[model samples]
Target: MRQPDIEIYLKDGDQQAVTDWLNATIGPCTPWRRQGQTFKCQAANGAPVTWLPNAVGKWHSLFIESERTPWEDDPAFARAAFAALGVEIRCAPGGWQEEDGIDAADRWIKINGEGEQEFIWRTQ
Candidate 1:
């Protein structure tokens, strides 16, 4: 049960706390899309980033947790924010393996405790 690297794309004018950023206080899927299978995104001041495909399942909900103290942490805000964004979070387990659709269809996101795992958020 290993977690993937979680890269975050913050906004230029975003001066919020780290937890706020993870909570999606500014927005959900900063530079999100619903048409194409793959797309690129850029932060307010950073360079461009890309999202191939994180997972499949009509994109119900999304959440993040720490592998060390996952159970001890509270993801209420994240869950609510995701719901507002149109997703339905069902479960969240850290230190797991996942292969998001970036390489394949939404059928990826396999939690195998391996390589580069990140969230690569967009704000532009």
Candidate 2:
């Protein structure tokens, strides 16, 4: 079975900064090629990744499309990103499930000020 894609959202940081951080953390990626509003590149592990800067409000969305990515899941990526970029990052708690539906519960895992992951349930 295909592994679930890893998704994460950044609270802040420009495109260049995010690309740089990804290179350093997940190993160097190929030069970013823009495709409309999103930028795509291949991670060191050969996973296809895309970065959509400011895709959601002020948060930048990133998607790891393949299981080849070095990290195992969203929280793993968020932890590494928070450490490297020192920025708040958000991701679905325990990854996303279609059965839950897009508006189902709307819980998230966000990095706190003390660099800890916190689970938050959005009322909306």
Candidate 3:
């Protein structure tokens, strides 16, 4: 079966920086022109992507809602985002599941400020 859609979160980074990276690496990204999204773009492989800022937190969401997304998976995107943005990144380990055991639902694979990948339990 095809892999699920990729969802990654940014802990801290300027929206413009993210926009620039997306425009350069993915495809030309334009202002979302929608109520909730910050930007909207298509990946090179033709997947729809959106950047959404959290209303009340440092974390922001990026959804690549197609199996055709360029990156292979969440960690791959996280690594690329870190290389481009030089900021912390987070994603559910191995993608999110309907019933992920071992309390993995709340766990994340984080790319830290220094670009080290580690498992973390996020409280916020």
RMSD of each: 12.7, 2.8, 2.7
**Which residue ranges in model 2 land beyond 4 Å of their true spot?**
1-3, 102-105, 115-124
C-alpha lDDT score of every prediction, in listed order: 0.31, 0.78, 0.74
Better model by TM-score, 1 or 3? 3
Ranking by TM-score: 2, 3, 1
> What's the lDDT for residue 117 in model 3?
56
TM per candidate = 0.29, 0.82, 0.79
The Cα error of candidate 1 at residue 56, in Å, is: 1.6
Greater-TM-score candidate between 2 and 3 = 2
TM-score of candidate 2 on Cα atoms, chains taken together? 0.82
Cα lDDT tens digits for candidate 3, 1-124: 3457887888866778887888788677545556554667666666777778872288888888887756788888888998888888888767666767657777778887665655656554
User: lDDT: which candidate is best?
Assistant: 2
Residue 91 lDDT, candidate 2, scale 0-100:
79
Model 1 segments more than 4 A misplaced? 1-36, 45-54, 60-77, 97-124
Tens-place lDDT digits, model 2, residues 44-94: 988888998887778899888986765688888778778777888887757
**How far does residue 45 in candidate 3 sit from its true spot (Å)?**
4.5
In candidate 3, how many Å is residue 53 off?
0.9
